[model samples]
Target: MEKTQILPRATEILPVMTAVMDAVDEESGKGQRDEATGPLFSENEPAAEYVTIGCSLKGGYRLTGVIAENTGESSIFIATNGQTERVAKVYHRYKKPKEEIIERIKSIRSPYVIPILEEGEIAGRFFEILPYYKNSDLLKATPLDAAFVAQVVVPQVNAALKAIHQAGIIHRDIKPNNLFFSDDRNSVIVGDFGISSILDDRQSVRLTTASRTLGYSAPETAQGFVSTESDYYSFGVSLLHLITGHDPFLGMTDQQILKVTLTDKLHIPSTVDNTIAQLIRGLTVKEREDRWGYDEVERWCEGQPVPVKENANRVKNIRPYVFNGEEIMELDKLALALAGKWDEAMKHFARGYISEHLLQIGQDLASTAADYEEETNREFGFFKLLYLLNPKAPLCWRGEFFTDLVRLGERVRECLPEINRDYADLLESGALLHFLRTKQLDPAVVDAFARLKERCRTDRNEAYYKMAFLLTGSNLMKWRGQLFDSVDALVGYLHANREGDIDAMAEELVGSKYFYAWLEHLGYGSILKQWRALPYGR
Candidate 1:
C-alpha cells in the first residue's frame, strides 16, 4: 500500500485553486444552469476540482491534491492524513442526507464492503470518505477468470449482499463500474451506494425511481420495479460481463433490452463450465422469484451445486464470419444494420428487402444496449456490412498482426498487382507481418493499410492504426520473440513471465478489448494457427 501523504509542492496546486475561486465567485449560486431546472442536483452546480469547500473533514483528513473526477451528482477526490488516505465521494445537494446512507453502509460488516471512515457536508454537497483503492475499478482495469469469479467476485459480492440484505438494505445500483479492487488485486470490493434503499421489515422492493443503468437491469426493474432480487439480477449481468467481456444486452435500447430480458433467456456460450453456467443462469432468471439470491450465490461460490438452468439460447449453427450472405438470420441482420449506408444494408435485410420491419426491430434492440457495446457492435457490424457490400474490399490490409508464417517479402511481391487493382480479395489473409523485428515493416503493408484508412472514417480506421502502433511503437517483438514459433519457446516464456500462472496470462491476453475484434478482422487461419501453437491456456 502507498503511504498517503500530501503533495510536498503545494505551490503546483495554488494557481488552479485560484482559478476555481474566481470561477466560484462569479457564479450567482447556479454557475452553469441548464435551460430548465434539472430534476436532480438543483441546489448544486457541477463541482470544479481545486475549489476548496468550507466544511472541515472529520478524523483529521486533508486534501492530497486538486485532482478530482466530477460528474453532475458528485465529485470524487483523494484526501489523506499523514498515515492513511481515502477517496472522498462528495455529492451535490439533494433531498436525502449522506449521513443516513453512511450509517446503513456502516451497519454491514463484510470484507466485500468498502469501509467508510468519515461523512460530512461541504458547502451543501454531502461527502462520504472511504478507503482509497490504488488501481482503478473493473471499469478500467479488470482481470478475472473462473477462479477469480469463484474466489473473489462471486463470494465477496454475495457476502456483501448477505450482510446488507440481512440488515434490510438493498444496493439499488450494481455494475462493473461500482466494483473495485484493492492495490494487491486480491480483494474485490463493492462500493458506490448512491442509490441504495433500506427495505422495511417485510423486505419488499423499496426504490420507485426509474433511474437505473440500462442493460444491467432486470425485466421488471426497468419498468420502475425494485426488490431484494433486483441486485441479484444486476450482479448476474455484471458476472456475465466479467466472464464474457461483454453484457448480453450490450447493444440494444432500454425498451428493446427490457423485451429481451423479459422474453429471451441469457445466451450462455457452450464453452463455459456447466456449473458456472448454471450459476449465471439461476441468477439471471427473468422472474425474480426464480432468481438466485445471497444463499444460492454463496453456495455456488463455495463450490456447491445449485439449480441448473434448463433453458438457454442455443446457437443453431455458428458462423465463422458475421457477414455471411447465405441467409439473413437474427445475427446476420444485426451485422447488416451496422452498415454505414441505408441502401446497402437494406439490400440484404429480409425477403423482398423489407428494411422498414428490420429497421424498427434494430432500433428497439439497439435502444436497450449499453452505450459502449452499442457503439462497438455498430462499428463491427458496419465493417462486416462493408465486406458484404464489396467482397473484394481490403477491410484488412495485407499485413495485420502475425498473419504469415512463411516468407513475408515474397508474398507481398506476389500480392502487389492485385492490391494495385483494388482486389484485396486477391491479397491472402495469411500474408501478415508475423516476424516483427524493430521497425522492419514492409512498405507494401504500410501502403495497403494507409489506403484502407483513407477510404474509411477516422474511428473505423483506428483499429489498424492501433495495431500498427502496438507492433512498431511498443516492444511486443522483444516480449513475444520466437515464442509463437515453437511450443518450447512459448512454454519457456509462459514459465518465466507468469510463474506457472498460464491461465492468468491467457486471461490477460484475451482480456484486451481489442484482441477479439482484431483476431476476427484478421483471418482466423494466420493468427489462429499461432494461437493454437501455445501448449496451455488454449
Candidate 2:
C-alpha cells in the first residue's frame, strides 16, 4: 500500500525468485511430465484396456498427457489405452456432474454427441473418459465459409440439441471448446456436459454460477436462469465465432460482456451473409421468450421461412434521439451509445438535445437529466443517468466498466501505479452509495460504504486501496503474481526465500497501516510480530 512499493518494484522481485524456483524445480526434475512407455497396441490385448505413465485407474484407462489444467469444472488430460487416445475430465473437488443428468444423456445417444466411455471415482473425486479426436475442436477449424457452417455445422449441432433437450437436460457449457469435430470436419460432436442441469416444468433452472463462460452465456444466465433458449444463444454465438474466427466480446471484461448481452442488440456485420445473419439475430435475441429454439433452427435448415420476433423489447420512443449519426429509438441502445461515446453524449446532454426524447420515456428521466446537466461532476451525473436508462448495465465511470464492487477493486489493482483520480472522486461523492442502494443491497453494506468514503477523504491512496481490498473480498497476499492465502504462508515463503535485502522488503510491508489492519482482521497478530521479529528492525 506504500507509494514507494509501486507495481514496477513489487513486480520486479518475483520474476527473479520465480526463475530461481523454476531452476530448482528443473534440477530436481519436479513438475515434469513423464514420457509414456509401452506399445500403442497388441494383437492379443483388447484396445479398451492398458497403461502408460505407471499410474493406473479403476477402469482400463491411464493418463498420458495433460491437455488443460484448472478449468472451471475439471482438469482435462489425455488418456490412452495404448492404441487409442481418450479425453479424461477429472472433476474439481466439488464439481462433479449430476448422476441423474449423466444417465439421461447416456441413454439418448447421437453421433453429434460424444458418448461417456467410462466414469468412476478416484480418491472420491469423480472423472469421466470420452473419445478423443486428434483434430481438436471447431475452434481450430473456424473462420469457415458460410456454406460450410450452414450446410454442415448447423444440422449436426441441431440434432445434438434435439436429443439433449428431449432428455430434459440443458448443456450449460456450449462454447467452441466443447464442440469437437471428426477428422474430416464433416461431423461436429458436442461434449463436456460437466455443468449441465435438469430442466424444471418451466424449462428453466438456477444452476452453476461460477462456471458459465462469459460472452457465450445468455443474458438470463447472469441471474442463474439456465434454459434451452440459453443453449441456443450460445450456439448462435459459436456460429458467429466460426464465421469470424473472433469472439465479438473478445478483450472485454465479464461485466462488460454481461452489460452488452443484457441491454444491447448483437450487431451482425452487414458483410455477413444475410441468411447467416438472420439466424444469429433470431438465436441471440435478448428476450428468452422470443429467442430461437429447435423448431426455428429446423425450419431454417429446411429452407422454410422462420418468424423472428425482432425488437420485442425496444422502447417506443415518440421521436428518436440521434447520436453517432444513428437514430436511437430504444432505451437500451441509447444507453449503450451514451456509455460508448460518453464525452460526445455529455456534450449533447449539456445542450439539452437528449432531454426532450427522455421526457417522452418518463418525466423522472427527463428531470434527472436536467439535474445532471447542471451538476458539478458531469461524469458522475452522466453515468448515473446512463444507469437509470438501463438498469441492467454495469456501472461505468470515466470509460472503465465493472459490474460490482469486486470488479471495481480489480480495476483499481490493475491501475495501482498511477491510480485514477475519478476512482477517489467517485468513492467520496456518494455515487456508489446511491448505486448500491438502487440494487437494494443490505443496509449494513451501505453503512460500510459510507464509513469507507469518510476514510477515503483522509489518505486518498491508502484508504482507496483499503476500500479496493474490501470490495474484492480478498485476503490473499500477492507478490508479483504469486498468491499466499494466509500470513503464515506468506511469512513462511519470505523466510525460505530470505536473500538480498529481505529486511528492506519486510520493513516496506510493515510500514503500511493498511497491511496491519488486514493482518489484524485475519487474527494474525502473532504472525505479524514474528514477521517483524525477523533480524529486520520494525
Model 1 Cα RMSD, 1 decimal? 22.0
- lDDT string for model 2 (482-506, tens) is 5654443554455555655665665
Model 1: CA > 4 A from native = 1-56, 65-68, 95-98, 308-538
The candidate that wins on lDDT is 2
**Cα-lDDT of candidate 1:** 0.52
- Give one digit per residue, the lDDT tens place, for model 1 in 408-495: 2223323321122222222222112211111233455455544444433434323342333223222111123231211223334454
TM-score of 2: 0.63
